[model samples]
Target chain A: MHLERLDFRLQLRALIRKELQQILRDRQLIFLLFAMPILQLFIYGFALSPEVDRLRLGIVDHAGSSISRALAASLVVNGVFEVEESGGTEAQLARKVQDGQLDAGLIIPADLERRYRSGQKTRVQVLIDGVDANTAGIASGYVGQILAAFNRQLTTGTQLPGELVAPQITFAYNPGLISSWFFVPGVIALVLNLVSTLVSSAALVREKDSGTLEQLLMTPVSSLQILLAKIVPLSFLLMITVFVALMVAFLVFHVPFRGNLLLFLFVSFLAILVGISIGIALAAYSENQRQSLLTSFFVNLPVIQLSGAIAPLESMPEIFQWMSLLNPLRYYVSCVRAIILKGVGLEEIWPNVLALAAYALILLSLSSSRFRKQLK
Target chain B: MRRVFSQVTKEIAQFRRDRLTLALAFFLPFVALLLYGYATRLESKNIPVAVKSYDTGTLSRAYIDTLFATNQLVPARFRGSDIMGPLDEGEAKAAIIIPAQFSREVAQGRVADIQVVIDASDVNNARVIKNCVIAAGNYFARSRDIARGRQLIVPQVRLWFNPGRDEALYVAPGAIAVILWIFPCLLAALAMSREKEQGTILQLYVSSITSFELVLGKALAYTLIALAQAVLLIAASMALFGLRLVGDPFMFVLSLVVFLASSVLFGTFAGTRASTQSAAVQLVATTGFTTALLLSGFLYPLRNITYPLSLISNILPARYFVEECRNAFVRGADFASQLYIPLALSSCALFLYLVTSNILRKMQLKG
Candidate 1:
């Protein structure tokens, strides 16, 4: 029995060494496994922001009064809108907007200063290109706020009752509201998913396509042992990716790591396990590398979308909100965000941790069972 | 030309035999359309805000009522005086604390201050929350003033193009662009690399088919497949999201054809460069998928992308295609005004085709 155990150890070690060598020898795979994640990290961190700014504005100041100029000036002062054209008819402004030269046009009427001086309510027309709905909504909101503030300034000290209620806003966790702090954690989850699932499934499918799995099965190693060997090395490599990504998030993006380091690593390890199991299940279901890749893409896209990695969960409809509960990546993202940004402990993130652990266990068991059956 | 046609027929035969690829080619785009249309809501709603009021006065209650009236910020329940509890526990995205004597101060004609603490971990959501809270406050004050019968300057806002702010109208066109680019590029790349991976390119090297004919053959087959994909996705968008062709269909169709050809040829180029199917797919995924999704102005506007990155976006075919699609579906601009998009698309297609053929010729010479 002692000799048998020793032999088992020897076989497992050999299998792991072989897997490592195969992975390391592929220069392209190594680049993809390591460099791509960092590259994507920087690109997404810098490029992706929902904050709307620098919209092109066209002003048709028919009034040509100081108030009209001040109103138009206020819009550009905040840098939300840039004055692209200041002197044009409303028709010309509309034409420019249609030609995609301007994002919005503000028309000040001819009687603007006269109406205001006479204490009669004045009306100004603001035409916004609403093809991009989100930007238009935000721009309109800005216009509303600016107009309200302008009204207050116009009516000040004239028995116009002051605002009875005011809100003092304070942003917690990230005082500056850095977008990268939010995106980096999500990117970490994304990178982990890509490496663990795509690479592992491709590795396995490539073996099956080359008929190496059958040859390996001809040996004395158990199917479970072979699977373990493949998973162990892949998980080690994925951990390195997670580490490098975390470093980039810290050094480059200045993403604060507030939670316990050990806890973050543990959660990431579970996430990697979940990813590898998903890849294994995909490999078991596909006949070739192409099919596996296509299937993975089909599966990964929805999972990533529903995970709230890019889009927020509260904004989704109720059904999808509930459906996101089933996605394991959701838990990973929540845990990472809570740990890194909120600096919450296991006590706060226990539910997410439990969910991730359950997913890792269940998926690993189901995929390994299917894989073992296929091997037999 | 006849050799290219026969090669196309051979490639189609191979494509049809792969039932999974065939199903994926048709089904994946449909799924992506559904997901992007329904699941992605840039307009944030139903943000949970914990409202902790220290006063039980009618004015404070009315203020709280007005806050939740918009339904943009929903009230979250919390048990304690700790305003930060719900935020830390992730139960609420923000917290509103109404100080004591708030209603009295307002009744005494002094301004009442309400403290709002927001979790800015998600910066965009935090910004939305801040705006919602402030808007609610402004609404409260404005309504009070209106009750008192005061005149105010009103801005008549007109939302042109998409007056209803229908998110699907904005999202669907971008989705179609991204879906078309990713799948065709992926399919073409895989098809190109599969021959090299299996050592079947050697046969082509020995055959009488010129390198141009071979590349043209593969490009034609995949473009045909992508054309079908484009039709199915556009139809699905129309049915699912109530998307309609708002302008002349000529520019949209012409640009779409060139766009698909360019994407497929781009894939073919990547396939020529990468020696294996996985490598080609990876190449497409990392470059093709990422750029098409991010830089193509799919979710965020092109203006949001800063310099250097914006420069990269200028070269991406998906960016121009997305612009043309948005114009076709939403803006309904004139055909002459939108002519530059198709021209840009054709130039991209020509460049990709030339590069792909050149690479194929080089491979033949080496062989």
Candidate 2:
């Protein structure tokens, strides 16, 4: 058997050309690669609003007086609660909440107004559905605010024999709590991670499964050449898709790019490298396309979960917090949020930037070595 | 019956060969549940705050102490005239400013202003901090009111089904249902599509067994495997997260069987529609799991969502199953109370089975 010397430039070019041809021919996948980001961007953008408005509130007003009616009106005044039914029993309200008709319900004592008139301590009950705990917690907070405001009004122009500590609130960065400001950067990182991983892994795993890798092996092209060919076009395609996703974030969500454009692009390039490496590594590990896809799903979700996009890292257990340090998505999310929201530069976000670079380098080398071993 | 039995043995044999797929089906849920269990918690406790106290009097100190007592906000480092500086730098999420007149104003029964500067870049955290600040102020006022022989209007918040609002308790049950739905569906979704891509479908056509037999055999094998996965997940949930079967044991198991059967059937249905194994894989990963996660009202309340979107959630079988699981495990609901969801799930499963079997038969006849 005679072995010819490897020609790096010629072999890589041919392999890349072949991969690009395959990508272009697979119209369904190309469409999926582009369309999935835009679809998810719109779906998550509109669907995921943290600002809880118009909660269904059932009122049980046993007081039956002007004061009680005024309290109920105050609850419904700010478009926070649309009054479902007034003057219902607590049992009726519980039934309504249990049956999914009302998200929450309020019960007023029979002597609420009388107690207010007589200068005695009184209480009002707010029952929240605990099924969706996040919404329930927020709704409970809103109820607190509503009641505090009512308490002030209830004692207005009258003397209260105690210290009244008034709290003045000031919100920075986003005063109105526009959820899009929070979601846009997160969606960008998530979309880039997803599209790049799926496309890159599918690219290589398809070749391996279809016996095309054997055809490439018949040539002088080495395993390294084949791996580069697989990653390069997908990385370039990922860059274009990410650029389009950033355009959506800017135009549709109106999230401004506050930091240096070059810095942002450089950081995105690092993130895309991380994504492609995971994809290639997952592809190298699996025998076929089905295995690769399932393995990638297992890998991607944990990366996102530990990334602190949806929840704060501080809130998580100490061990998961440590585990998040290894997650490339965590640094990507942190850097993007800092650049867009805080308008911080490289000096402020160098650690995260370095982390992304380190992750890309480490993951790329590991996956390349694994791919070479699989080739053997 | 013998044909079906042989098919089951063949599937189990194939399943044994692929240790990776077997490990994924058996164990990915445990990892996913652990990650999501810690990751999806929305409660913002131990949030750092900066205190700029212009009033070092006893009243001001007491007020700051009251804020700390909630255990929601902890004091962090802050040094600057502008409170926004530290907040923008991410040193602290909130800052409290106690005015010099705090002691005097409170002593005279006058309204005293204590400013809380919140970084609202994270809206959820901001809202939680704002509420905590308000509650702290109210507690201070109510304590003083009781001392001064004054009346206070106390507000009681009662949370049903989940009293203490433990995040793990809320996430575990839903995570189990999602795990049961996703893993088996993925494995079964691939069975038919893999055969098509590998030309085994042609081999099946040349054989004497009918397409109904093939589809039925595949479904039965996977249904058994999924049932095993269900048991593993339930045990994991209980052992790891302290999830208990508060309702009838038989009813919960029944619900689990129904949900598992329907999910695998749905996967089989998706397989028939897909032309390639990759497409079916994508269907399981992106479409099936995402539909179950987002549309099932697992994380968010369905009632709060508006008309058309709410209507769309009704069509997803996972929605009913998640509700059923929560009802059985958390609410301790009985069979009589939860009859409708099981019936609905069974109908969906039967519908998908009939559709998939028909498609398989049609493909066989054409071949």
Candidate 3:
């Protein structure tokens, strides 16, 4: 009996060692796995952004008054805005904004001269498409701020000649618009999902590919125990890798070290388990390494979509909101954010802990059952 | 259990020479974190425009000159006399006219008017222009009235959540999920794809292994890896970005489980359909990426889109993830309120498992 246990351990260890060798041997995969994420991070920092700047501007003035002309000049002269188009009907202008051809349009009424002469405030409507709330919202705000400044100019009227107008305004979190701060942390969350899943999924599947899975199965070991052993090494290895990644993210990216590391570690511990179990389950399910990788990719979409990493959760319909509950990434993001930003303890993040643990349980239990069924 | 250990050792021994497999297992997380951190963002930039000013006086000159000075547009140079010509020729956004009498009228305390002609070709750009104008004009008028001793003018405006109007502020929170979601899912989906490419899938099927076992094994292995990577990524993010999470971590993890399931299901399901590993990877990755970005309410919110289109967003998992993450991290909502998301996800996972297992079983026999 003791000899049997020793033999079992020997076999399991051998498999782990073999698995490690296979991964290390694939230089292309290692490069792809690591290089791809870093490249993507750079792209994200450079390209995809909600910030709208340098809008094409169009102006139409009918008053023919010196005042009308002067005003048009001031509108575009502001560094914050740019002059693009100059002539068209309101209907025609509306069509331009509708077609996605232009970002902003300006109309100076024909009676613009009359409004100023009669001293009656001319009401000019600024229209905006609410489709892209982010861009639309920003454009609208910029226009408002600039206009408020202009109001001050007009208050010192030509006739009245000497009063300043100022509007009350306030700025919120990330007042300076530092894109790095916003993206660095987000990238940390995104990168881990790819790294952990990719590596873990390939491990067990490789065993099956190498003609070792059946050999292991033939042994007298229970399927569940075999599965548990399979997860142990990979789990241990991944935990260390994650720590390295985190260290890189901090040391290399200089992202921000505001949150409590202890809270983060606790959450990381639970989240890592869930991720590892998912990988194990995939390995158990896959007949080949290719299948395991492909399976992981196929599942990427729904996870990202339901997680609210890119879009507003409330903005999405209620149904989709319910669907996202399954994405472990959402919870990871939440936990990461809490640890990084709030530096909260387990009590504060317990809900996330429980959720991650539950997810790990589900993945582990199901995979184990599947393994048992496979054994049968 | 003793036999199991022996088997594990044997499995480990059979592949000691394969270094590629081991390298990916531990090093992939850092790579993924760095890539996703840099790839995602809103695509919008530099618009071109032409300007024509009709006004000759100081005020009109000030206005038209201001238009040219705006950085958002690439300004076209023109004389005041050519205002209409530039506009008609489609060379300018709008031609501004300042009556020869503009300055005198304002000095005399009379209402002075200005007309702006806009090109309606680009609807959105036109609106942006209009917004800029009304805003600029109101400012000019407010102070002008005070100087002339005319009726005081006060305009009341209402603002929403982002008073500073920073678009990134709103995007920052959402981007966390939008960019991060792809990791677990894409990784899970790819795991099986890679195994198929390596010719390992066939060997696993010949054994007495059930489809459920196969799927579970794949899912668990990948999940473990994903969790580790997530930890590192999270740590990196917190250390570098200072992004705070005010909500429950449990809720966040719960959401991730659903995301992983959907990602793997697609891969597993796609594998059943595709004949080759490359084909599976291409098909699954494309579908996953497109669906999440376009339909999952990431770039565009359902509420802002057409109702019918919004309805389509319902079937997408990203939609819920976005909301749930926001609720979990931002609002700190309780587990009960969040229960609905997990319930829906679990059901989906179950459905995927059933379908995948059935198909795999069929494929195992036929292939």
Chain A vs. true chain A, TM-score per model, equals 0.95, 0.90, 0.80
What residue runs in model 1 are displaced by over 4 Å at the alpha carbon? A159-162, B79-81, B146-151, B365-367
Looking at every candidate separately, what fraction of the true A–B Cα contacts under 8 Å does it contain?
0.75, 0.62, 0.03
lDDT of each: 0.87, 0.79, 0.54
TM-score of model number 1: 0.97
Error of 1 at B142 (Å): 1.7
Better of 2 and 3 by DockQ: 2
Candidate ranking under TM-score, highest first, comes to 1, 2, 3
Residue runs of model 2 more than 4 Å from their true location after superposition: A1-15, A85-88, A95-101, A159-163, A217-224, A373-376, B1-9, B79-81, B99-110, B144-152, B206-213, B248-251, B304-308, B334-337
Please state the error at residue A55 of candidate 3 in Å: 2.0
Classify candidate 2 by CAPRI docking class: medium
Query: TM-score of candidate 3's chain B against its reference?
Result: 0.71
lDDT of 2 by residue, B13-64 (tens): 7776876778778878778878876667766778999998888679888888
Query: Compared with the true structure, what per-residue lDDT tens digits does model 3 show for residues A230-301?
Result: 566656655565566566556654555656776666666666666656676777777776657756744554
Q: Give per-residue CA lDDT, model 2, range A1-376, as digits (tens).
A: 1223335776788889988889978976686578878866765665556566688889998888897888888888988788887336888788667655677888889998778878787988888877667677777877776776776666655555333887889887777787768777887888888888888888888888889888888887788888888878887887888788888888888876777778888988999899988988988888888788878877998988888776667677778889999899999998888888778788768989998999999999998899889888
TM-score of chain B of 2: 0.93
Residue B257 CA error for candidate 1 (Å)?
A: 1.0
Interface Cα RMSD in Å, per prediction? 1.9, 2.9, 15.7
